[model samples]
Target: MVVFFDSLQGVLVILVMIVIGYILARSRWFSPSSSQIIARIVTQIALPMYMIDTITKDFTKQQLAQLLPNLKYPVISMMILFGLSVAIARLLHVRKNRRGLFQSMFFNSNTVFVGLPINMALFGPSSLPYVLVYYMANTTFFWTLGTYLIQRDGEGTWKFDIFTTLKKVFSPPLFGFMIGVVLVLLDVKIPTFIASDLHYMGALTIPLSMIFIGIAIEKAGLRNIKLSRYSLGVLAGRFILAPILMSLLLWRADVPQLMKQVFILQSAMPVMTNAPVVAKLYGADADYAAIMVTESTILSLIAVPILMTLLQK
Candidate 1:
């Protein structure tokens, strides 16, 4: 009981920042380009620095080794979710235009934007390597299979660009992580000045990420949201199904408790923020994707605290 409230308090701390962004976006304080600007700064700039700072500082070679294998858990979990997404899509009789997009959004999560900040707030920097591991698995799958499926929805044929897929997979943050890992393996240490700069720049990740979510919500329009079988099905996949499946997969695994907790929490995050962009780019229903993002992101505030309490027990 107390645990739940404590978790709620942590989420509320995050909510305050999100509310600030929501207000700013609503009041026209944030321009149309604000979300894109913030996202680029967070992903291309802030997140990579954060990855380097945490990975280089907090993780040792042995610890990184232990963490790498755990990636398989999230990969396996997502694969199961992917299969279930197909089954649920057919069961729901989702439209052909939106069916592939539906399955993509159902299985992929907002791992970096939502997952990182919440994990840091709940578990601190020590949870980072585990978080990165999950991010690696989640990002790879989302870019490759997830994006391909979404593209298929738009094109209605087997269409995949390996060059584009590879570019997405080996993203800036992953490059940062790889650099950190290489330095660790090579026994190289960053100079004090450079490390300090990275730390300062990395500090922007959390608050900016939360604000991005807020902007996304505003862009999606709260009035536009409506409950339907499709939304309900996605809600089930994210809030209920994903976490439960993660728990089952991790139940008997030999790993750190924090790893288990972080994995479970991350598994159930909102639909990917990139969903709408991909849907729109590929000529699918961007509005539907946007609604799913808004719906899942809003519900995750409630879901996170509840999931936290369960993780505590």
Candidate 2:
């Protein structure tokens, strides 16, 4: 009973923070423009600092060995699930543009900004190693596989500016990851003062991410988009079914118990914010992608708690 309550309490705290952001946005206390400004700060600065801080601490070869296998596992599973989603969309006779948008948004997730917070809350600092490992893998997949998928049905071909694509792959988070590897390899020690400073900056990830999410929600109004039973089911599949399928696969592959939990937790995160941006770039259904991002994020607040209880057990 106590265990269940504690878990519920932890989940509720995250929800409350999300709610606070939502209220602030809905109440017009923070204008949409202001939210975008803050989001830029959080995404570019705080998020990278958090990644650097989290990746630099206590990372070792042994930990790497334990973590790396599960790293690729979740992402590979995600690709498979996303492919299935596209196939499902086709079978439903969805329009090509809408299908493209659905595929992009359904597969992509807000891994850095939103996922880090949810995983950190559920697992703690001990989850850092796995988080970094997963980040490394997910980043690679995002650049290569995700980009290709986004471009496949749209303007840019997979062969378009491969070098530029690779450059994007090595963006801030991956840069932090590389620094972490150097530290691990050189056995360099960071002073507690510097570490503590980084930690302070890192702590902004959740609140700022929630605010960004709230702004997104406001931009993609609840009433502007229409939701149907089938669309709701796809959202459910993305949030619930995908995680369950991945969990079973991870278990079969003998991933570490804790790592499996993280993978499943990550899989359960809502559609990525970048999806809309990518869709817009490709001249795909950017608005639809945006709607998916907003809807899935709002839905995941409920879905994730249920996911936690199911996957953590």
Of the candidates shown, which would achieve the greatest TM-score relative to the real structure?
1
RMSD (CA, angstroms), candidate 1? 1.1
Q: Please provide, for model 1 over 1-313, each residue's C-alpha lDDT reduced to its tens digit, 9 standing for 90 to 100.
A: 9989988988898899999899889988988888989999999999999988998898888988787878899999999999999999999999988888889888888889999998998889999888888899999998988888888888656667788888999999898888888888888989999999999999999999999998999889999999999999998999999999999999999899999999999999999999998888888889999999999998999999999998888
Instruction: Let me know the TM-score candidate 1 reaches against the reference structure.
Output: 0.97
Taking the tens digit of each residue's C-alpha lDDT, what string does model 2 give over 4-67?
5655666676777777777777888876478668767776667677766776675575776566
Q: List TM-scores for all candidates, in order.
A: 0.97, 0.87
Candidate 2 positional error at 308, Å: 2.0
RMSD of each: 1.1, 2.7
lDDT of 2: 0.70
All candidates' lDDT scores?
Answer: 0.91, 0.70
Regions more than 4 Å wrong, model 2:
1-4, 27-36, 151-159
Candidate 1 at residue 22, lDDT?
93
